[model samples]
Target: MSASFIEAMTAAAAQRPNALLTVASDVRPCTTRLAEVVAAGQRMGTRMIAAGILPGDIIGCMLANWREWLVVAVAAAHAGAVMLPIVTIYGAKELGFILRQSGAKWLFTPDSFRNIDYSAVVAGCGELSGLERHIVTGPAFEALESEGAISQPVDVNPEDLALLVFTSGTTADPKGVMHSAQGLLAELETMRLMRGGSDDDAVISPWPPGHVAGALSMYRYLCQGSPLVLMDQWDAALAARLVEQYRVTSSSGTPFHLSGMLAAAEANGHDLSSLRQYLVGAAPVPASLIEACQRRGLAVYHCYGSSEHPTVTSGVVDDPLDKQLHTEGRAIIGSEMRFVDDDGNDVPAGEEGEICTRGPELFMGYLDPVLNEAAFLPGGWYRSGDIGRLDAEGFLLITDRKKDIIIRGGENISSKEVEAVLLGLDAVADAAVVATPDERMGEIVRACIVLSSGASLSLDDIRDHFSAAGIAKQKTPERLSIIDELPRNASGKVLKHALRNCS
Candidate 1:
């Protein structure tokens, strides 16, 4: 636990040189050895240091799920630089904010991923004062891989900032969350304790490498030397194929992802008996979906966590059916949770209040100093901004969310940010964004718009406007309703509850 990620990876690779780490993608599917990944990271890290990257420099990466992405992540840790992973879906608006806020010095991206042109996106950002170089992911990037590993080891502390991931919180702008090497390793250990696994287990991760869960999945292979199969993007049919082909044992995702995989397995008649445990979170989980997985001989359990604190509570496979179906499970080992009222007083045993937790896996703090005070309470407990209560048997059940955000297919979208974008449209006089229930995605953005006088708009028009604004498409409102005005209370604040009720 005292060693940094690179140190742990080096030790693990020395012990298991031939361990497998496979990446299954549309472009290429290659199974790499543990030694090969470590050597590549070392070579890349040596090149990075020679290129003038300091120990604490921020390196931004906006690549899709590829083996090269993992190599860059490892290389950042090797060179003692903090890795800031930008979601590939982010456009100029979000990307520019992150680069400017984090002050990233070096950026690594692909020439093109899917339909997005990295060169164009970078150019769209205009100017970045802190960015020293931009390296595209092709022969030029491959050339950065020096011929040999560095002879001297980099001195990295366990408590040093290793990762800076931007999360869409309840605010209009993204919050930069910092994590140390020790914190990430603690998260992996907590996960291991939560789920009992075997040495023969192989994991198929459909998560994008930018998200916190995806970042942790990649770290699992580096720290534990486990065989991991990475998917560049989420494709239910392809996920089923990878699971059957690789005999994958466990995975984690939202209920939406689980439903798709289950449907794909049923339609294709794929043998998915190897997949035993699926950790479902990041959105509301339905009891019916859990029952369906049970009928299919797959063990699906609910988990509770956020970017601030990863894996606070998790359900075990051996838990009773009633508990697994009804609750999000109890706090894992070394974690403490409690419910607090608005006044910060402890709620009664069976009452619902905001869920607060503190553990070794908690993030260090937000990059902006002003946000940290409101994010955490005294005694180092993080306010989850969620309403949940513990049952008599110590299981946590989430009742509602206090934060105004919509989670669509495991991605958190700030409703305020969406509303701000909607208000920028000339056709929109006023806007209020709320979450409407969705059968598949759990929740989606619904916009209640007050159009300007003598102006009109449609869903297609809103989508095109969002595209032109350089915002992520997922934040665009899926369902729209033009109204005379948004209902307001005495204080002139929009009554979001009324909008949700009507939606």
Candidate 2:
């Protein structure tokens, strides 16, 4: 295996010079052949060095999924600089926090994207102490590329820090999660082994470049020498067209992405026969959705992991449908998983408890030492803050998040259980269940729902639906609020804390 990302990318480019990294855009489609990608990356690396970027320096990038993003990412690795990918959806507040907290000296972003003037946003950032350079990607980047290429790539140790990705802060401020070059490369190797696909297979990546899923997909493409089709903005109809045009063979995203793709394909009569696998995660997944995708000849696999450690467990394409729908598969190679109680003692198999994991793919630690102290247990295991159970077959069934459960009166209710039942209904498009303040019961279950197109639902309707599903009465939502869309972070995870505060 390659020691660093630069080595892996250079080798892949040499083997497949003609392969392309295609960017799907509504304005215009763009592509960079492997040879050009390599050349540009080398040139940018040299420019970065000339600009006084040193090894171990953090360089922040807040750009969308485009050719420029890939070039800058590889260039950062080539320059031995640690990359900090900031989600494009972040506004000035989040941007300021990440930029200041990460101590990124140089930041690369587009002047404007999707009507957001990032240059203006950067200008408005107050008191970012370490940010000395703000480079825009269009014309400014071209001038930088005018510099000559470097003789060789910068030397970096395998264990050197490479990436600092922050978690989507739903309940609190985002925390930066660091990863070494060796750890991330090892993860790619494990993923390549588990999901075997040739260079000829085209993969569609709709995830934002800042998210770990998007970054990992880009690296996976380079590692496998596959053609990557990146979507700048997600539109289900446009995605369907791209999949048909590019013959996309594999993809990964949350259930929201899968659902949108299915609906678009069905409505537009797009042929999705070329799709071989769609790995779904990042939220509670409904079995009905998986069944629906399977009936349409799309292989839907459930995946489980977190920002701290990705791809802990993922269903295989060849697994039985029941397993795919019910479990998050077994522990991936190089990863160990265990269920534990609040005190960190291991829980017996088939018992519900918090999931703890230790793996080669795990992040080095949070940027804050205080946060790191609270993140791990006595062993090396990272507390996942998720509740789950391991079945006899070793498949993991994630029941709920540790903090997501609601206590109505004296009974505990899993919000995921109620949401799952709600999603199983034909009229519900999306749902998030959270605890609402109750005078008598202390806290009661309240559901924030997004109804299917042209469908309506009431509190009574939700109660009847839960009752029909045989869910416990306490778990049924006592109040329902129909909204146009559920509030979500960039990763497609519903912000339940936001829902809890909603009137």
Candidate 3:
């Protein structure tokens, strides 16, 4: 798409070396310019090669959304090595599994983060035969950046493996998803076009860099010359402040983040006029949230995608209010979408089916090729495992995940459909629907809810709300648990598997 990640970075640095890149932390925001970040990456890449990293070698990083994480990503790409960004939430058990599974030869992490002793975690990973070095950030890492730049960055093909991101593994162990330089950049360009980024645009990425979205934010800074504001920890008040302070134009997160930021802004009387578009996905978006954003004069829209396919469909700011609110928009340029039944046959138009996509932005395959067999349908289409239907205008309405359908007394209930109804209620702040075991009904809808502040709701109240919505009686949540918050992975998707085990 742009030659490669490093090529894009190098070109952008030459064009906009003074562009700002800020990292917001608890203490203060650390800001740097494009030239400095590129120089740091080049130095680190040289040091990596001096330490024996080769093309295609996997370098794993288990860090938060720190500035150094971006530098290391650039370093990895510059050296033609694959970057494996492990989420900081992962412990030694999960970390060990990923390192061993990915066969990563190098790892970069801090000694500790947020009171978690990552050095101890690395020590506890036991003996990893393939691991050559585990470099902790500090003097050791700073020394690497002090090295002289490489005479020449390694040349890599556009299709060479450049990124290895693991799924959130809400159900099973995480799978190592591989992405080539071309695929990652293609997705980046699609997003850049979707957001209508410009040199004047400033983006605040609240996601952890270990996630694909975060990685792309860093690349967007290096490649597109868009100023980036990164947050290590998610604080709604802080995010609201940063958005106003920096005049951020575009950002993306789940409904949880968007709602929280809006609340924080309202509480502090902060005017978030700088924000132009807030791209939302990775969870079921509530229509009320969209309505709330609209009331505040914010452009919020739904986007549908996952790790395997970063972005399949995304709504735009100019779409009709109904389309923007109700559907994840049509396929972006260069992407194709199809619908298929469980039998792997094409479903008729307007019929719900598993969403299949194939395009330049699609991932090559999982690192564990065995997992790829079931991941893709015949004819190179990647099975997204999500169920949705296309409208006459090509807008996609995602009903539920294939696994998310709750069968209650032989009737299929879309969890999102029920959750949408629940969210329409005044008291319900956030909700997640899961299938709970039942003695006679096979499985019933169980809703875990987070209520609004100073608001209250009972099972009967929820039932009444659903009754008012004119939805099927069976779709009403048979079981309800009002909790503080729904469990979420880094990308803000609900951990439905964890909820299934909850009593």
Candidate 4:
């Protein structure tokens, strides 16, 4: 067995080719193969560490989901180098910001993905002077893998940084998320309890490996020796087909992504009975989608957490439908969570406030000191920056992000709550509610909507649609912008911050 249990599975794969994670169409190791990946990482670690790159010096990687990527990642952790994962959608400027901020000395990027030249993106990054190595996926990444990497290992403790994850939260600038091996391992154990993993299980997912969810699946599935069926991109029809073809036991994606899958399955008549649980999160689930999933015998679990505090709140798969309809279920095992007021005092049950957490699952701390001190309570519980209320049963009902709440006439209106109302409207296909800058009433709730295709819906029609549904007049959208499409990130997340400039 390899040093890490996750690697033990990969080593097992070396002898048995049954374990797999491959992107469909043009199947080649972005690193050629796992053996090469392990070799390259070992070589780089020895060559780089001897040259003074510390165990935690961030090594950035941007690639599509490929099996060897995990091998290199495990190799980095074992070699004591911090893994710096960046989004694949980034241009040169954003890539440079991450590389520079993380103090990265090495970068692993694909030559091209869907024909976007990643080399061109990094070419524009500030300076290549600090970068000692630039390995491209196609041929270059494989070249390094062919020559055996240094076998020497470094001494690393559990508290050492294993990953440097970057995220912007609901509405903010991107911040570095440094996670120690111990904390991540704890979260993995929690996930195991939640997932009930097994070697016979077939898992399906489409989240890119650069993000937390994607990376977590890579290691988590490996620990139990499960085969991961991956989609290079989130195409609903293709996903449903893969589930049926792979005989997948579980599937996951963002709420919208899963909704798309359900829609495509309903439209194209794909058999998705293999999926026992439809894991989803990163946004609110509409009532229609919930019903649609429930009809398929696939239970939908809502996840409310972030990169800094991952998998904190999860709705159990067997939760009561009514409880699942209102709240995101209870906290996962091994975490302590509460709703706190503006003054950091814990609020009574059912009172809306920031969701604060204290547990071993949290990241080490944010990279910025000023930000770090402001982000957590003195007792070490990290403030989630999301406003929510815990029911008497300890189920968390999130109202809105603290910054996304609209204060109209001194009443805080959750845009997410209002969006749920808008989604219930028959004419509306999708909606996003935001607090627009207002000269009066502090801020007004405004909605941007995309109507159901072929449905000629007007602004007043939607307002009346909400009003007739018993939605409070004040809670109804004051102003509506009808757009053909909503601004979304690559992961199917509606970027409200991008919508802020729509007006």
- Residues 1-503 of candidate 3 have per-residue lDDT tens digits of 34977898889899999899888886335889998888898899988888889999999988787778878888998888999998776666558878999999989998787777777777777779999988888888888888574647889998989999986333335578899988888888877777775777898887777778777777778877788888888888989999999999889986767888899999998879989889987666678889888987788898887778888899999888899899999899899999998888999999999989999989999888888888888889998888999999999998876656665533345676677778888898999989887644557889899999999888899878765554436667889888888999999999888888887
lDDT winner between candidates 1 and 3: 1
lDDT of 2 by residue, 1-503 (tens): 44787888788888888787888775436877876777787788888888788999998988888777777877888888998998875666568878988999989988887877887677667888899889887788877655574647889887878999986332335688899878888888887787787768888987787878888887766655678888888888988888999899988876667778888988999988999899877655668889998887778888887668977998888989999988998889989988899888988778999998999999899988788777898777899888999888889998876666665532345676567778988899988889887644557888888889989888888778765543436667888888889989999998887888888
Per residue, candidate 4 scores C-alpha lDDT tens digits across 2-62 of 1343244345446534455545546442313334444455665555566566776778878
Please give the CA lDDT of all the candidate structures. Answer: 0.88, 0.80, 0.82, 0.71
Cα error of candidate 4 at position 428, Å? 30
Most accurate candidate by TM-score: 1
lDDT over C-alpha atoms for residue 213 of model 3:
72
Give the Cα-based TM-score of candidate 3 against the true structure: 0.81
Residue 216 lDDT (model 1): 87
Model 1: weakest 10-residue lDDT segment is 145-154
TM-score of each: 0.98, 0.81, 0.81, 0.76
Per-residue lDDT for 347-448 in model 1, tens only? 999999999999888899999989989878899889999999999999999998899889998899999899999988899999999999999888889999
What's the true lDDT of residue 265 in model 3? Answer: 94
Q: Which ten residues in a row have the lowest lDDT in candidate 4?
A: 1-10
Backbone collision count in every prediction? 0, 0, 0, 4
Best-to-worst TM-score order: 1, 3, 2, 4
Span of ten consecutive residues with least summed lDDT in model 2: 405-414
